[model samples]
Target: MRDLDETDVEILSLLATDARRPFSEIGERVGLSGPAVSDRVTRLEETGVIEGFTVDVDRTKLRGGVPVMVDVDLAVDAGADSDSEPLEAARERLRDANPVEHVFITAEGDLRFYARVEGRTVREWLSGTFEGVPVDDWTVTLVDEVEWTPSIDGVEFALTCAECSNTVDSEGETARIDGEVYHFCCSSCLSRFRDRYQRLEEGA
Candidate 1:
């Protein structure tokens, strides 16, 4: 695995500020050639450092509604063997529901989501949306405005091992199996993953 360097972080910062910035411009700032910058960017994509380029759209201007934030407390299912699956299912349902832009799970196992309410009060929207959902209680806040800024300052990049979920350091290795790249903290993990994958393929 390639260790993330200062140049990579600079390239990421540039891209985060403006995804449309030319590779040549980034190369100039990072003291690398255009092709070198392109190569590094491609490697970053392959290593999952760069997921994808996307635009930050102002949803309020596009939709006819009042933007609001909702915090939902979920009921724990005592009868269920595992609560994670149910929580995930509830989150998916909320995501698929209308006008929800961003969804997050808090450290205390509460759900917070941003949405735009149209033609209805916050109470009505909440009552209608959380009809069959496993919810205990909820609170809503009207959003007046929003400002989002993404930065890479003081960020540390560490890839996780595919087999053991350990952090991949300088001593780690990367493997490309069946056209998909995988990272490992050590050669033993890589070998074990390969063996298990081969066995699964043979069984299939």
Candidate 2:
């Protein structure tokens, strides 16, 4: 994929703030015609860059409930490694757990599964769902608050030039690793970065 231009980055920034913003409104802000903006938006959607529009439903407002975060540590099969299929199976098991809203596999220590549970009392839901499960360990963190930002920490953004420190446009074709975002000036820089990282890993 080719790198994104300034206009594309602007469009992404606008969308990142409000996914449901209309093409006409976005076009007005970005100095593009409505149809032109729509075409770009359609292309982004088709290419999977814009996954889907979603609403952040306030679960707490429903029946006066509170949201809870559950950390589930799975006891993998004796032969199973971190990325083993059995780990996947264990994650699939949580699909039926009514309290689970989202699950993530963390690269952190032994803590494998992170589940977001929405219920009146997070502790009660976790106790009921985890009953009889052979969990290695678990931790619960109450989500005190959350804030959405245009850019994330640790995700590498492409540099404008190898010599310049300016951020490269990140409308599309940018790869995100861990939390760091990287933007390549060209294929050569991308190759160079990968080669250096590979050597570092080998040495380690």
Q: Estimate each model's TM-score.
A: 0.41, 0.34
Q: Tell me the deviation in Å of residue 58 in model 1.
A: 13
Query: Residues 1-204, candidate 2, lDDT per residue (tens digit)?
Result: 444555665576567657788889989977899899989877766655566674232324322234445566666657545544545555656655534434576665333333344554566766666566656666777766543223559664333533123344421113233344455433234444667767887899
Over 3-81, each residue of candidate 1 has an lDDT whose tens digit, in order, gives 6665765576567557899999989977899999999988877766676674232223222367778887777888988
Judged by whole-model lDDT over C-alpha atoms, candidate 2 comes out at 0.54
Displacement of residue 67 (Cα, Å) in model 2 is 2.4
TM-score of 2: 0.34
Error of 1 at 129 (Å): 2.7
* Candidate 1 deviant stretches above 4 angstroms: 1-63, 154-204
- Specify the highest-lDDT model's number: 1
Best by TM-score: 1
> What TM-score would you give candidate 1 relative to the actual structure?
0.41
The lDDT for every candidate, in the order shown, is 0.69, 0.54
